[model samples]
Target: MVNRYLPFFQGVVLNQATPTHHPIPGNGNVAVNFDDEPPLLEELDIDTGLIWRKAVSILHPLRSVDPSLHAEADLSGPALILLSLAFFQLLAGKLHFGIVLGWATAASVFLYFISSMLLSPGRGGRGDLSLYRCASLLGYSIMSMTIFSAVSLFLPRGGGLIFAVGMGFVLWSTRVCSRLLVACSGHGDGHRGIVAYPCFLVFMLFSLLVIF
Candidate 1:
């Protein structure tokens, strides 16, 4: 009697010991590892939130003025911030979204190209930095102005205070961009000042439009 049940128990034990492998869809004969832990979905969310918060912090005048932060800047995070701000401006109906986005993107690309030309190769034979990096520096540096643009939409007419605040942000963004250029381009203060001038003009133009 025990012998008959012994066979069934052995079969069950064997099945349990042998891990089942599931073939991944569309990848023929490729089996997923049952022992491997699945990637955490929450990580992506946390990373995105962190990037957004950094973007917002960069908009602060005091924070953007920090040279250390400029060195660590990357394109993806700031680009997301700019795009989100543009979307909000569009929803506010204060300006044409297409024009705003088109100009902002164009300015970022144009400045990146122009600045790259003016920059010396990175220090210690590191070679020239990528356009994406330059664009990130410029894009994130100008984020202060982007915030001002979004905020101006909600301010009442004849608000001199709003205009003053926008100007301050514009100046701060220019300073940030200039400092970043000094860091990345390995250029002296004078050259960096020259490089940052166009950034100032661009922000000034945009801020004026938003303020008026």
Candidate 2:
């Protein structure tokens, strides 16, 4: 019966571990799985020196083509951008925190499929951008929309100006995201517009959220 539930036990069992790491065990060769141990503070890679520089760089689409802009795979910068977005939306009397995170995740997965799977090998864009990298890139890319959301709080409702500004920020995000995809994934500049389209749509969705 324990054999039938062995997988469940394995899932929860902590690795008290063996005698090699402790005094010699009286029991038969002590068996343990150390996978569940909480990481120590020293063991954690608490390095966050890059978050500020990377966040600042993300605000500039011109730097998007520079591979160095995305040298690290990080979610901290994106988390900050997302939190700011939620804050702005909250100020605008629309609490869309859940929708923002969900859509960001969906958009990341969608772009990952596009860049990592849909592009033919001949097109030179396949399997180069991992889902984690795509998520990180898009998370940073959304900073433009985050800014737009903040600006939108002061703008009048039902005006072309808001729409125009939203479109501009959407373009900004598209430029940064698409260029990063090309630069980081080694895709040719020729396919940049193709990548930009989906990115444009992703940003446009966020912009529309800002508009309404």
Candidate 3:
């Protein structure tokens, strides 16, 4: 009976693990005992800072080559741009237009988040989500809504200036968030850094073009 339920226990342990770490390869014979103390940090070199560096290395290029990364990032980029654009429209005293634009931006962001969750390597146990990830998403969502509200309230005045500030925040926030996700996955290496950075630069440039 005990042997039959061993795998079940293992699954629970795995589910609770950090995204950056995986089972010690070839250690399957180990039983999952809940009463057992959590694994030691040193056992896996599970440093958040180290993991972040590794994530940048792994994701930078793979993301660059992966068509899905391009598609997903593009979706996120446009949503961010629209969100900023809506603020400008509202600031210009176009309330109805701004609301419509804001709504559209919101929808796009939802899709972007969904796609990112699905397509990014860490949505499941192998690339599991974490508190930090949830917080990052929450912050972005709040910023998006706040910008819209501000535009709605103060029109034909501070739209461009506020929009620019918002865009800067979006750019830096997305870059850092992506890096954190990579680090948490514990694959610290520059393998993916090349692609990710370039693609991000392109995205930034595009946004700048829109701004200017």
Prediction 3 global C-alpha lDDT = 0.41
- By TM-score, the best candidate is 2
Kindly report the root-mean-square deviation of model 1 from the true structure over all alpha carbons: 7.5
114-169 per-residue lDDT for model 1 (tens digits): 67666646432233446667667766765776777667767775777887888788
lDDT of 3 by residue, 1-212 (tens): 33565888877777788464345658964544545666676455444443333224323322422212211111233334345555564564544445444444443354345435543566332343343343333233233333444544443334577456646544543454344435444334342353244324433432332333
* Global lDDT of each candidate: 0.67, 0.81, 0.41
TM-score, candidate number 1:
0.66
TM-score of 3: 0.28
> lDDT score, residue 17, model 3?
86
Model 2 misplaced stretches (Cα beyond 4 Å): 1-43, 61-65, 118-122
**TM-score of every model?**
0.66, 0.75, 0.28
Q: All candidates: CA RMSD in angstroms? A: 7.5, 9.8, 17.6
Ranking by TM-score: 2, 1, 3
Q: Please report how far candidate 1 places residue 105 from its true position, in Å.
A: 2.5
Compute the lDDT of residue 6 as modeled in candidate 3: 89
